[model samples]
Target: MELSHEYLTENREYKDYKDFVANCKLTKPENFNFAYDIVDRYAELAPEKRALVWIDDFDDEKIFTFTDISRESKRAAAWLKSKGIKKGDTVMLVLRRRYEWWILMPALHRIGAIVIPATDQLLQSDFEYRTNAADVKMIISYDNPHVQTEIEKAKVNSPSVQYLVTVGPDREGWVSFHGEYEKCEADFPRPEGEEKTYNDDPMLLYFTSGTSGYPKMVLQDFTYPIGHIMTAKYWHGVVDDGLHLTIAETGWAKSTWGKLYGQWICGTALFVYDMNMLKPDKMLQMIAKYGLTTFCAPPTVYRFLVRQDLSKYDLSLCQRFSTAGEALNGEVFNKWFEKTGKKIYEGYGQTESTIICGNFKDYSEIRPGSMGLPNPLYDVEVLDPDGKPVPRGEIGELCIHVEKERPIGLLMGYHKNKELTDAAFEGGVYHTGDNVTQDEDGYVWFVGRKDDIIKSSGYRISPFEVESVLQKHPAVMECAVTGVEDPKRGMAVKASIVLSQDYVDRDPKEMEVEISTFARENTAMYKVPRIYEFLKELPKTISGKIRRIAIREKDNKKEDK
Candidate 1:
């Protein structure tokens, strides 16, 4: 029996959520390693099974098999071992969607060495902070002029690094990874004695692409991927042999959410669009070309898709679509639905845990703008600051209560910051810094980032709620709502918008008044923006979340608003 079956005790096709969550139980085996038990197991059972279908920016295509990955990872593990990356040693791979990421990451896991998957887009300062923060001993990266220059610059300040490796080209002072793997033996034995790993051993660390403050290092145990079964099967609706695509860079936790872990475990062939930048036309072409059965991306991608001539694309084969990273706009949801007749499902979680809530099939009805139900594996609630459960109509912080049962995918801790970790896990509850309201039907509506809430004349406002209304206007493409410094209300509702291309030439004052009027008509009076700023683009984190703090800072320094 497979690991999924071993862990997922009964009811694979569960429909009623209350009954499904009530019976959901994972059987934890004593010493389970994903690379060996899952990856190699598939290689043994079905060696020729397709693992990855990759396309590059140049329109080049390549395919890989489970056998190829298993062999490559073993060889890579041996080569990494030869380079002195042993158990518990930290190795950061800056290989963005390059197929090498698939091989090297699992290879790191097989040897029990800690893996930190960073993006190739890191600057020198970013690299220095990550390397020193994680005590990374080795760095494997995609070789490019900028990336190469930054790594060399960071290495001067990053003294923990003992070896430098590159994947593509032969460079001086760097081990050519592909060249070394070819020469190394295809079999690597697991380290003996102290090298053995428990299911709870730290296997992965992700630096949260945060909006405010320094990035927090999120640590997840070896069993982390098991939790994403909820992500792939239930939320993404992935099927074996079908192609599934989730847009994410290797550095982010979303890659493991889509590309690796659950998709592979569920036997889905992952579609990787390894490109320098995202293009709406390119993604649509890939969908039609690959016959992608299931797909997930951030709402911004959907916003761009809705901008294109969507009617020209043939995407009938795609069974389900999902979005995360930020709240899905109601207008984007409605437009895509009108074009494709498919409602974009929403999921919510963070680097610290797997899918906490989602619009899973049959388990929850399609509530166009809702984040669906909490995953059956975890106990989710909206709690007040005092830790008491908030009423259905009220807004509160979203939290996962682990007192009764600590689910399989919860983060181990903040790697080295016990203070932040303890504060997050206070009262046996992990408080997600998201504000939300629960409806009578238990569907959760995202309000806004916890810190981005606006208090206007004693009326608390949700920026997300206001933006959802703004998105309904034809002129609005993407928008961010943040509180501006107000002398009377303490904070005033301000809208920073990126207008749709068609509306660009329109007069700014007219467009603003129209959008402002639209919001006033649709939402509560206090939620309407008192000030509107038109922009070419909104400032966003690498993960695609709007940098509201940046918007707020710019709003603060203004004298006569």
Candidate 2:
């Protein structure tokens, strides 16, 4: 029997998609804690089973068993507790894909403290804002020169910060993580009474990318991981005794979605490659070398992979492939499937929730450019401006039903911001702010975000649709589509493109016309970009998502000039 059967109603597998939607249910255990209930339990039962397979750029490797993880986490918990880190205290972790993160995450969870994962690319300003806003009592960092300096600079003004712990070699004014943990006794019993965590207690906090405004804290309780059972076992198609590789850093929520919770609960081993930089060829080599069975990555990674000679690598062992973060383009999807003989299953979700919709292995038919069907966990619907569900073939805001009961994995609220929380759940449902259209067959197709839609003449154009068409062209390496100021039409479609290396030196005027004609031929005339600007790179957030709002802001400044 699968390990997840303990938490799920019955066998997670279903004969068909309809069966899953109709019968799937999760049994939420009261006072649930994944660290003790799952990790420790696995250690006690199957101590020798592989839990993590880690590798670094230096070719160094470390394989951890469930028993090893339990021991290391216990030691870490003892070390942290010695420093006065207790229940309800907030701690920030900036260890990027490091093995110690695997140790510290459970350690934090076991202690009932909240874990906030952050990227190492943050600047001093970003650090200041996060530390102050979250009241971060302690920060466990990986010693990158820039990151360490920024943290020091931010610490002067951050009154809540009482401890600075670094993971590498010891430095003055910093407590060495390994140094402290090695000396601590590996015995941390689970807390009792008021100290124990419940199903509704906050376990994780994520700061949004701030694409539109200042970052808001997204808080999720201990029950969050239970929701991703659909993500790994079903949508990602993680197999029994499989070694799954999800290309994401521990800093982001995507790590929890793929690298940690769901995969572990299903008794699958995680393959982690701690690379200094992401090169397509290197990534392919790791997959082949490790004999990884299931894989998931964003559209950007697939786009890079499709450009390389895929036949050179032996990826025969990797049977399942999936993509998320952004919608998978038709061109990339087709090329990958043609080369590898596997379809790229697309899933849709956000930091606020788990996989709300996906192309599961059993039920959903693979639509080339669609987000597939909604997951059984969420009552997904496309609602219009007036909060009425739209017809099958029309576009509207995607919302989840929550008036009856908020789903297990869904966020509690934006931490300390009741006004923002109320606005998000103003209606009986929780608004996703993403716009999509559902076909008669129940397949959901992504239109751009609510703010991203462009009104040109009388047509509402989806930036994703135009971007999909442009991505098919060889000259366009990357692109962000947005609406620009046009006095007559009110808004005209504009594309900011990053040219491929082969076409980077070509005449801008000639390439612009060539790309424009290609897009016009492939897509609707109305959806074709009226204005094109070629740049070295498109503006993106720290997490590598395109910032369309930044592009529009720059265009507005130019219009004023």
Q: lDDT winner among the candidates?
A: 2
lDDT of each: 0.87, 0.91
- Give the per-residue lDDT of model 2 (tens digit) for 47-118: 898999999999999999999999999999999999999988999999999999999999999999999999
| Per-model C-alpha RMSD | 1.6, 0.9
Which candidate gets the maximum TM-score versus the true structure? Answer: 2
Tell me the lDDT of candidate 1. 0.87
Candidate 1: the clashing residue pairs are none
**Residue range 1-561, candidate 1, lDDT tens digits:** 233665677737775777767776666677778888788988999888888998898888889988888999999999988898888999998888898899998899988989999877789999999999999999999978789889989999999999889998899888888887789999987656898888888999999888888889999888898888888888898888888999999988899998889888788888999988888998998888789999999998998888788787889899999999888877888889888898898998898999999987777677877888899888888999999999997999999988886788999899899999999999899989899999998999888888888889998988888888888888888899999878898888999999988899999999978988888889888888999999999998767789999898777677545
Q: After superposition, how far is residue 477 of candidate 2 from its true place, in Å?
A: 1.7
Report, for all candidates in order, the number of backbone clashes. 0, 0
Q: Note the residue pairs that clash in candidate 2.
A: none
